[model samples]
Target chain A: MPHRRSAFFISDRTGITAESLGNTLLTQFDTLEFKRETIPFVDTVEKAQEVAARIMNSADSDQHRPLVFSSIVNPEVRAAIKVDGALCIDFFEAFIGQIEGELVQRASLTVGRAHGMINEEKYDSRIEAVNFSLTHDDGVKLKDLDEADVILVGVSRSGKTPTCLYLALQYGIRAANYPLTPEDLDSPTLPKMLLPFRHKLFGLTIDPVRLHNIRTERRPDSKYASMDNCRFEVNEAESMFRQHGVAFISTTHKSIEEIATNILHKANLKRRF
Target chain B: MPHRRSAFFISDRTGITAESLGNTLLTQFDTLEFKRETIPFVDTVEKAQEVAARIMNSADSDQHRPLVFSSIVNPEVRAAIKVDGALCIDFFEAFIGQIEGELVQRASLTVGRAHGMINEEKYDSRIEAVNFSLTHDDGVKLKDLDEADVILVGVSRSGKTPTCLYLALQYGIRAANYPLTPEDLDSPTLPKMLLPFRHKLFGLTIDPVRLHNIRTERRPDSKYASMDNCRFEVNEAESMFRQHGVAFISTTHKSIEEIATNILHKANLKRRF
Candidate 1:
C-alpha cells in the first residue's frame, strides 16, 4: 500500500451489501487512503473479464496492489477473474460452504429473506405516491409541502414516516407525511392547503389493537398510544379515505413494501424515480 | 364495486411494480380509496401460505377484495401464494416464464460467480458491522454528532447524499453528511465541527475527471462542473482526509451502496433500525 489502498467492489447483483460491508472495515486501516470503485450487474464472463482487465490496467498504473471484494454469481466467470492477480475476497466462496452445510444439516423450510424488501427508488416512490394528495391547494410550491410526494392522512403512527422515507430513499421520490390530527379526521374538510391535490390523496389505517402495540414500542403508556384512541382514529381515517376518495393501505400486518406498493397502485401513478 | 375505486399494490417482495402499474390505471376507475398490503419475504411456501391466508381473511371481512401484486423468486412459493381468493399478481411471475424459456433454449451457467467471496465481516467487525446505520433521525438530534455510530464527510457531489440516504433507509443508521467547500480546502485544516470527532470523521472523494462528468449531467458546462476545478478540489480533499487522520473512500465509480458501505466500514457503526 502506497499511503493509499485502492479498493474495488465487484458485484454480480446490485452490489449494495458489498459496499455496505466494505465501508465499515476500511475505517480501521487509517494509514491507507481507500480509493473505491463498484462494478455492478457483472453477470457475464465478458463483463467479468472486462472488469479484471480494468483492474489489472489500473493496478499497473497506480502502484498499489488492490484489495478486491466481489459477489459474482457465475463460477466460470469468477475463475477467469481470479487470474487477474488482485487480492480477491469472494463472499460466495467463503459463505457457500457454511450456508450449504447449514441447509443440509437443518433442512429448514426457510431459504433466506431478501434484504429490506426493496430497492431505494421503488421503495421511495411507493411512499411519495400515497400521501395527502386530495388536500393540497393550487399554487403550493412542492418544497412548501414539506417535501411531500403524497402526504398520508391517517391516525398517529400508521407507518407514515418510515413509508415516506422508504419511498424517497428507494425511488428518489420526495415524500413528506403528516399525521391527521383528531380534528382533521373528524371534520369533513381536510387541511385547507392540501385541497387542490386531494386527487392524489392516500390514507393509512391499521387495526387499533395493532397500532397500539406499534406505538407502545416508541413510547409506552401514553394517551397517544392508547388502544381505544388508536381504534377510533384508524376507523375514522378509513371513513375519511372512503368519503374523500383517498386511496389507503392498512399497516396491520403488512410490511413497508406492501403498503407503499398498494398506495402507488391506488394513485395510478408510475414511480417518480 | 363500491361507489369509488381505490388503488391497490401487492408484493411477494414489495408491491412496488404493481403500484407503478396501478397508479396509471386507477384514474380510469371511479373515485377510489387506496388500499395497500404486502406479504413480506414470500420466498418460502410457508410464508406464501401465511400471505394467502391473510389476504383471504381481509377479503372476507371487507366488502371489496383488495388487489394484490408481488415479486417472489421461487416458483413453488409463487404458486402457493395465488391460492388465496384475491385478485393477486406476482411481479417476477411476469418474467419467470420468459427466463425459463431462455434457460431452456440456451445453456445457463449452473454456479453463480458471487459464490467465492470471503465474508469480510467474519474477521472485520468494526467497519463491516456499521456500514448501514439507520436514517430518519427522527430521534437522533443534530447536536449529537459525536454520538453517531458514523459520520460522513465529503464535498458536494462526492457521493454523500445517496450513500447517507442508503445507510439511513436500509440499515436505519442516522447518517448525516457535511459538505467541504473550497474555503475549508484552502485552509489546510479540518472543519471545526470535525476536530473533536476526529475518530468519527470519514472522508469521501472522487476522481475529479469523473466528478466533472457527473456534475455535467446535472448542470452542463457550469463552473461547478469544471474538470480542472474538480481535480483541484479532489486532490485537496484527499490530502485533508490524510492530514486529519480520517480514512477516506474515492467514489469515482462506486454506487451509493458501495460508498455507503465504505463509510460504514470506517465508522464502526451498525444499522440500528
Candidate 2:
C-alpha cells in the first residue's frame, strides 16, 4: 500500500496561497496520498508554536515527517513553525528574499495583506459584480446587459451559472449568463435580446452525454434531460455561436476556473483583481 | 510614483495557482506597483515562446525586466519561457525537485491537472454546493435545512451572501445564509426556525456604518438603509447570536475569502476541496 501522509497549509491569513501552491505541487506526485489541513491566521508566535507542536505530533504518529507549506510573513512566527520532524517549506522565506533582491527593496512583512480587505475599491467592486451576476443570472434581468464585461450564452446545464459566478468572484468581472432556451435554440438566429451585445457574447457547449447526465440529476425522466434534446440544444447553440462570429468553448470536461479563464482570455476582458 | 513593473503569471492550465502565489508574493513589496497579466494555457513549447516574447516586449517597453511567475510542468515548455530580459520565477522548478528528494519519488510531469476536472466526484460536489447555496440564499428555501454544513445568519448587507458563495465555490461547503429581517431583529431571541440548527449556525456582523453604506446603495436612504436601523439590526443580531451561544465573526473589513475561512475554522467544517 502507498504511504498516506499528512500535509499542513499554514499561513497568517486565509492560507489560500499556501494551499494553492502546495496542492499544485502535490498533484505532480500522483502516487502519494495526502490528508491535508489548513491552519490559517497563525500570526502570533504562540499560535505558531502550537501549530508546530501539532505538526510534530502528526509526524510522530504517522512515523513520517509531514510536509508543512507555510506562507507566514512574520519572521518570529515563521521561526516558531519550523518543527524538527517536518519538512517545512516556507514559501515567503524562499521567494521573498529573491523578490526583494530583484526589486531592490525590502519586503514590508505585513500580515494578512494578500487576501485581506486592503483595497476597498477592488473589494467593493467584486461584491458589486457578484450582485450583478446574481441578479442577471439565467436571463433574469436584461436591462443592464450593457454593463456586463462578458455575457455567457449557453444551453441549460451547459455550465453557465457556475462559470459566471466564478468569473465574478475570482476576477471581479461583471459576468452575466443567459441560458439558450429551447425556443431560442429552435430559432434560426441568436436571441433578439443578445443582438446588440454580440461582442460580449461567449457561448459554452457540452457533450450531449454530460449534459444529459447533469440535467438528469436536477430533473429526472424529462425531455430536458433526454439525450436527444441535449444534443439538439448543444448543436443549435454552437451553430448560432459560429454563425454570429462569437467565440465559444466546450465545458464538457473543464472546471469552472478553466471555463471562466478561457472566456476572459477570448473576450479580452480585464480582470479587476 | 513607484516603479510600475509588469508581472506575468504563466501556467499550463488556468494559471490560477500561479496567480494566487504570485499575487501573495507581490503583496509583500508594498512600495512596488505591478501591472499584472495572467497568460494561461501555455502548455506547448510554441505557446511558451510566444509568452516569452510577450514578456520581452513588456520588458523593453517598460525599460525594466518583467517578473514571470510560471507553474508550467513540461520541462521543454518551461525552458522555452526563460526569456533573457525577464526574471522567470518557475514555481514548479523551484520546489518539485525538493519535494521529489523528500518523497523519494518522481513527479508525473502531467499538464493541466491542477485546475482541470481531475476528480469528477469532487468537481460535481462543488457545483452542487454552488447550486445549493444559490437556491438557499437569503433565506429563500428553508427546506432541507439539515443538509447545510453551516448556516450563516446576519443582517442584510452584513456580507453573508458573498461569503456563502465563496465558501461554496472555494471549499465546496454547503453554506446557506439567512438574513435577519427587521421583525426578527426586533425580538430579543433567535429566530425560531434557526433554533434547531443552533449548532450549525454561524453569525456574521458588520459595523453599523459599513452596513448603512452598503444598504443605502441598494435602497437609497430608505428606512432599511438608515444608520439608526442599521445599528439596531446589528446590535440585535449580535445579541441574539450571543444568547443562542452561536459563533460569529465581524465582517466589517474582511474579504469574503477571509470571512469564509474564519467560519470554516470556527465551525470545524472539513473543506471538501
Candidate 3:
C-alpha cells in the first residue's frame, strides 16, 4: 500500500497562494496520496511553533517527513515553522530574495498584504460587479444591459451563472448571463433583446449528455432534463452564435475558472485585479 | 520615479495560479510599480514564443528586464518562454525537482491539469453551493435555512453578500446571508427564523463610517444610509451576536477573501475544494 503523507500549506494571511501553488505542484505527482491541510493567518511565532508541532506529529504518524509549503513573509515566524521532521518549502523565502536582487530593493515583509484591503476603490468595484452580475443574472434585468462588460448567452444548464460569478469575483468584470430559453432557441434570428448588444454576446454550449445529467439532478424526469431537449438547445444556441458572429465555447469538461478565463481572453477584456 | 517594469504571468491553463502567487510576491515590493498581464493557454511552443516576444518588446520599451512568472509544465513550451532580456521565474521549475526528490517519484508533467476539470463531483458541488447562496441571499428564501453550512447575519452593506458568495464559490460552502433590517435592529431579540440555527450563525459588523459610506453609494441621502442609522444597526447587530454567543468579525477593512477565510477558520468548516 502507498504511504499516505500529510502536506501542509501555511501562510500568515489567507494561505490561498500557498494552497494554489502547492496544489498545482502536487497534481504533477499523481502517484502520491497526500492529506492536505491549510493553516492560514499564522503570523505569530507562537502560532508558527504550534504548526511545526503539528507537522512533527503528522510526520511521526506517517513515518515520513511531511511536506510544508509556506508563504510566511516574516523571517522569525517562518523560521519557527521549519521543524526538524518536515521539508519546509518556504515559497516567499525562495523567491523574494531573487526578486529583491533583480529589482534592487528590499521587501516590505508585511503580513496579510496579499489578500488584505489594500485598495478601497478596487474592492468596492469588485463588490459592485458582484452586485451587478447578481441583479442581471438569467436575463432577469435587461434595463442595464448596456453596462455589462460581457453578456453570456447559453442554455439552461450550460454553465453560465457560475462562470459569470467567477468572472465578477475574480476579475471584477461586470458579467451578466442570459439563459437561452426554449422559446428563444426555436426562433432562427437572435433574441430581439440581444440584438443591440450583439457584440457583447458570448455563448456557452455544453455536451448534450452533460447537460442532461446536470438538469436531471435539478429536476428529475422533467422534459427540461430530457436528452433530446438538451441536444436541441445546445445545437440551436451554437447555430445562433455562429450566425450572429458571436464567439462561444463549450463548457463541457471545463472548470468555471477555465471558462471565465477563456471568455476574457477571447473577448479581450482587461482584468481589473 | 520608480522604474515601472512589466510582469507577465504565463501558464499552460488559466494562468490563475501564476497570477495569484506572482501578485502576492509583487505586493512586497512597495517602491516598484508593475504593469501586469496574464497570458493563459500557452500550452504550445508557438504560443510560448509569442508571449516571450511580447515580453521582449515590453523590456525594450521600458529599458528594464520584465519579470515572467510561469507555471507551464511542458518542457519545450516552457523553454520557449525563457527568452533573453526578461527574468523568467518558472514556478514549477523552482520547486518541482525538490518535491520530486522528496517524494522519490517522477512528475506526470501534464499540461492544463491545475485548473482542469479534475473532479466532476467537486465542481458540481461548488456550482450547487453558488446556487444555494444566490437563492438564500439577503434572506430571500428561508425555507431551506437548515441546509446552510453557515448563515451570515449583518446590517445592510456590512459586507455579508460578497463574503457569502466568496465562501460558496471558493470553498463550496453553502453560505446564506441575512440582513439586519431597521425593524430587527430596533428590537433587542434575534430574528425568530435565525434562533433555531443559532449555532451556525456568524455575524459581520462594519465600522459605522465605512457602513455609511457603502450605504451612501447605494442610497445617497436616505435615512438608511445616515451615519446615525449605520451606527445603530452595527451596534445592534454586534450586540445580538454577543448576546447569542455567536462568533463575529468586523469587515471594515477586510477583503471578501479574508472575511470568508476567517469565517471558515472560526466555524471550522471543511473546504470542499
Q: Which candidate number has the best DockQ?
A: 3
Segments in model 1 whose C-alpha atoms lie over 4 Å from true places: A1-149, A213-223, B1-11, B15-142, B209-232, B265-273
Tens-place lDDT per residue, model 3, B1-273, is 459999999989898889988988899987788999999999989988898889999999988999999998888999999977888999988999998898888889886665564567878998999999999999999988999999999998888888888998899999999998988988879999888898899999989998899889889999989999888888888888898898999887778888899999999997777
Q: Is the docking of candidate 3 incorrect, acceptable, medium or high quality?
A: medium
TM-score (C-alpha) between model 3 and the true structure: 0.98
- TM-score for each predicted model, relative to the true structure: 0.54, 0.98, 0.98
What is the C-alpha lDDT profile of model 1 across A30-117, one tens digit per residue?
Answer: 3446678866657678988898888887677777566676655456777666744567765444443432342232212111111222
Two-chain DockQ for model 2: 0.72
Clashing pairs in 2: none
Model 3, residue B232: C-alpha shift (Å): 0.8
lDDT of 2 at A175: 92
Q: In model 1 chain A, where is the ten-residue run with the lowest total lDDT? A: A106-115
Q: Write the per-residue lDDT of candidate 1 for residues B1-273, one digit (tens) a residue.
A: 542222234444443334433332232222344454423334568877777777777666665455565545456776876744455555444433442342233212111111111322321221222222332122223466755656677777776655665665555565656688878788779878667767766788877876787678668988888987888888888888888788888766554555665565556566453
- Scanning candidate 3 chain B in windows of ten residues, the lowest lDDT window is B111-120
The TM-score each candidate achieves on chain A is: 0.52, 0.97, 0.97
DockQ of each: 0.06, 0.72, 0.73
Q: Poorest 10 consecutive residues of model 3 chain A by lDDT?
A: A111-120
Q: Which is the winner by DockQ between candidate 2 and candidate 3?
A: 3
lDDT values for all models: 0.56, 0.89, 0.90
- Please state the error at residue B6 of candidate 2 in Å: 1.3
After best superposition, candidate 2 residue A266: deviation in angstroms? 0.7
